[model samples]
Target: MTAQAVAATTRPRPARAWRAVLRLHQPALFLWGVFVTLVSAVLLWAYGPGGNAAGAAWRRKCTVDLCDWEDYSVDRYHFAFRFSEAAIDFMPILVAAWAGAMLIGRELENGTAELAWTQSVGPVRWLATKLTVPAALLTAGTTLLVGLHRLVFDTQQVPKGWNWSDNGTFEANGPVAIAFPLLALALGALSGLIARRALPGLIGGILANATATTLIGLAGPHLVPWKISVGDLKQGYEAPSGAIYGGEGAVTSTGAHIPDPCSGGEKACLAAHDIVGFYSEYHPSSQFWPLQLTETALILTVTALAVAAAFTLLRRRTA
Candidate 1:
C-alpha cells in the first residue's frame, strides 16, 4: 500500500507488450524488412543512374523537332519506376491481407489471444499494440518509398508522360500513400476481430480494403472543386498544364452547358444548339496539395474509426 510500490504497480509496461508483439510477429517483421529493403534499392537506382540515363535520352530524342524512336535508355528507368509505383499502389492490399490472416486471425483461431489476455495483457492493450506497431512500421516504410518515388519521377518532362494526376503516380507521390496502408491495417485488424478465423479474415479484409480503395478513387476528383476553363467560339478549349481533367462541354451565351454540337466544322450545327463557347473542368496544379491532403484526412479518419471499432468489439467480447 506504500506510495512508491503503488506507483510502480500502476506504471504501464508498454515495452513488455511491444516486445511480446514483436517476438510473436518476428517472421512478419523480417519479411517487411526485406520488402522495404528491396524496394529502396531499386528505387535508389532508378532515382540516380536510371533517371539520368532516361533524361539524357529524352533530351537527345526531343531536340531539333526530330526524335530517335530507337533510343532505349528510357526503358530500364521506366521499368524500375513503374515497378516501384505499382508495389506502393498495391501495398494496402498486401498489408491488409497479411494483417488479417496472420496478425489477429491466427492468434484468435488458436486461442493465443486468450492466453495473452489471461497473462495480464488485457484485450485493449493487446489490440492497441497490434495496431500501433504495424502502423509505425508502415508509416516509416511508405514515407521513404514515396520520397524516393517522387525523386524517380520526372516532373519536368515536356508533355509529361506520367502526369501528377495519373493513378499510380498520384498515390505514390503524397501522404495519401502513407495513410492508405494505415487504413488497410485498421480494416484488417477489425476484420480479423470480427471473423475470428484466419481464412475468412483474410478474405474479408482484402475485400473491405478493396471496396474502400475503389470508393476513394471514385471520390478523389470530387474532393476538390473543379476549376473551369472556358473559351469563346473563335477559340478552342484546352486544360491548363498539370490539371486533372474532369469533363468538357460546349457553353451557350445564356450560360447553359451542353455537349459539343458539332465536330465536322459545321458552324450551322453549333448555332442550332446556341453554343457560343467551350469549357473544360479540372483540378489545377495548385489544387494538388489540397486534393492529396483532403484524401489523406478522409482515409485517416476512417482508420481511426476502424481502430476504435476493433477495441469496442474486443472489450464487449471480453466483458
Candidate 2:
C-alpha cells in the first residue's frame, strides 16, 4: 500500500471532526432537555420567593396558635420539595435515551453503519469520533446545569436548594449516577452495530433507558452503600410532606401553637414545643462527603461497566 494509504488506515481523524456527529444529534438532545428546564422553572416559580401559597397558609395558621413561629423561606421550601435534585436526576437519562435511539441505532437501521465503517476510518475510530461530540456536549450541558443550580442556591437568602441529602450532586456527575440515558446511548450504539435497524434501535434504546432509570432511582440508594438517611422523624423535626402542626388559631393535640413565639411575650417560649429548629440524628449536611463519594463511585462504576459492555459488543460486531 502507498504510505499515504497506510497512514490513513492507521491514524484516526482529528477529534474536531466529531462536531458533525454532535450536530446531527442536537435535535434529539434539545427535545428531551425541555422537560428538565420546564420542571425546574415551574417548581421554582411556584414555590420560590413569592410562590409559597401552601407554605404561607401553614405559617399563617401557626400565628393563631401558641406553639412557635414558623419560618418560611424559598430555600427551605425548595429543599423540602426537591425540585433541583429532580432536574439534575432527569437530564442525563433523557439525553442518553434519545441519543441511544437516534444516533447509533438509527444509523445502523438505515444500513449506514456499514457505509460509515467502509469509509477511510475503521469501525472503532468512526464510533469514537461520533461519540466524542456527544460526550463533550453532555459534559458541558451538565456542568452548566450544576453551575446554574449553585448560583440559584447560593444567591438565595434561605439555604433551600442542593442539600447533600437530596441526591443533587450525583445527578451532575453523569458517569457515576446510574445515568440510564448514557447507558442507553452505549447500548443503542452496540445494538446498532449488531441489529442494524432504525425501529429496533429506537425501541431497544427507549425500553432500556426507561427501565434502567426507574430501577436505578428506586433501588440505587439501597443496592449501593448510602450514607444519607431520608426518613428520620424522631431526632428533631420531620416534615417530608410539609406537615405543619399549627396554623391560624387552630391547635393540634400536641398543643402546638404558631404565632405565640412572635407574640412579644414570654408565652411564646413555653409554647414552642416540637419546633423544627434542631438537627436530625441522621443529618446529611454534617456528613456530605461520605455520601457524595460513595454515590459518585457507584455511578461511575455503573457507567464504566455499561461502556465496557458496549465496547465489547461493538468490537466483535459490524455496525
Candidate 3:
C-alpha cells in the first residue's frame, strides 16, 4: 500500500465516530442549547435584578414592623424560583425520550445502525459512542444549572414555602440533579435496545424513568437511619430548618401517641393524657450530604446496570 493509504488506514476513528453521533443529533443538541440558555437567564435574573427588587420592597415596607402585603414583590420572586424548580424536575423525562427515540431507537428501526456497522465502527463502539457523547453533554449542562440554582437559592430570602427539604428543591440543589439525567439516559438506551422501535421505545423510556424516580422518592428516607429528638412539651422544641419531619407525637405512658385534642394548659394536658413529653424522629440538615450521596450512589448503580444490559442486548442481536 502507498504511504497515504497506510496513514489513512492506521489513523484514529473514535473522533470521527463521535462527530458523526453529534451530527446525527443536531436538532436535539440545538434544543438542549436553547434550554440551557433559557434556564441560565432565568437564574441570573433571579439572583441579581429580581432578588434585589424583592429585597428593596421588603425593607421599604417593614421597618421593624410587620410588612403590609399590598405591593410587595416577594410573590414575583417566588414565582421565578418555583418555575426554575419545575423545569429542573421535567428535564429527566426529556432526556429519556430523546435518548431512546432519537439517539438509538430510530437508528435501529430504520436500519441505519446496521448500515453503520458495515462502516469503520463495530456494534459496541457505535453504542458506546452514542451513549458517551450525549451523557457528557447532559452532565455538563445539568451541573451548570444545579450550580446556578444553588447560587440563587442560597442568596435569596424566600419564604418557608421554598424550604430546601422539599422534594424538588432537594433533588435540584444537589448532585442528584446530575445523576438523575444520567440514569434516565441509560434507562432510555436500554429501553430502546429492547424495544427496537421508535415510538414504543420512547414511551417505555419515559415510563421507566418515572417509575425509578418514584421509587427513589418513596424509599429514600429509609435508606439512611433517622435520628429521634425528645423534649418536654412545655419547653417547646422545634426541629431545625431543612430538617425532614418524620412524625411528631406526645410520649405517653401507653407508648408514643400522636397528640390528640387535650384541653387546658401544658400541665393540664400532660396530666389529663398521662403524656410525659413530645418526641419526634427526623432527618436533620446535618444528614443532607449523606442522604444526597446515598441517593446518587443508588441512581448511578441503576445506571450502570442499564448500560450493561444495553450492551448485552446489542451484542446478542448483532452476534
**C-alpha TM-score for every candidate:** 0.88, 0.57, 0.85
Backbone clashes, each candidate:
0, 17, 0
Worst 10 residues of 1 by lDDT: 153-162
Better of 2 and 3 by TM-score: 3
Per-residue lDDT of 1-319 in model 1, one digit per residue for the tens? 9999999889565448888888989998998899899989998887777677777887767665555588766777777877988999988998999888899998999999998898878888889888898899999999999988887675433323567887798889999999999989999989999999998899989999999989987888888899999988788686787678987889888998788868524789888888888899999768879999999998999899988899899999999
Q: What is the lDDT of residue 158 in candidate 2?
A: 33
Candidate 1: list runs displaced more than 4 Å.
Answer: 1-15, 60-71, 154-160, 234-236, 258-269
Best lDDT goes to which candidate?
1
* Candidate 2 residue-pair clash tally: 17
Q: lDDT per prediction?
A: 0.86, 0.52, 0.84
User: Which pairs in model 1 have colliding backbones?
Assistant: none
Tell me how far the alpha carbon of residue 134 in candidate 3 is from the true structure, in angstroms, after superposition. Answer: 0.8
Better of 1 and 2 by lDDT: 1
RMSD of each predicted structure: 4.1, 12.2, 3.9
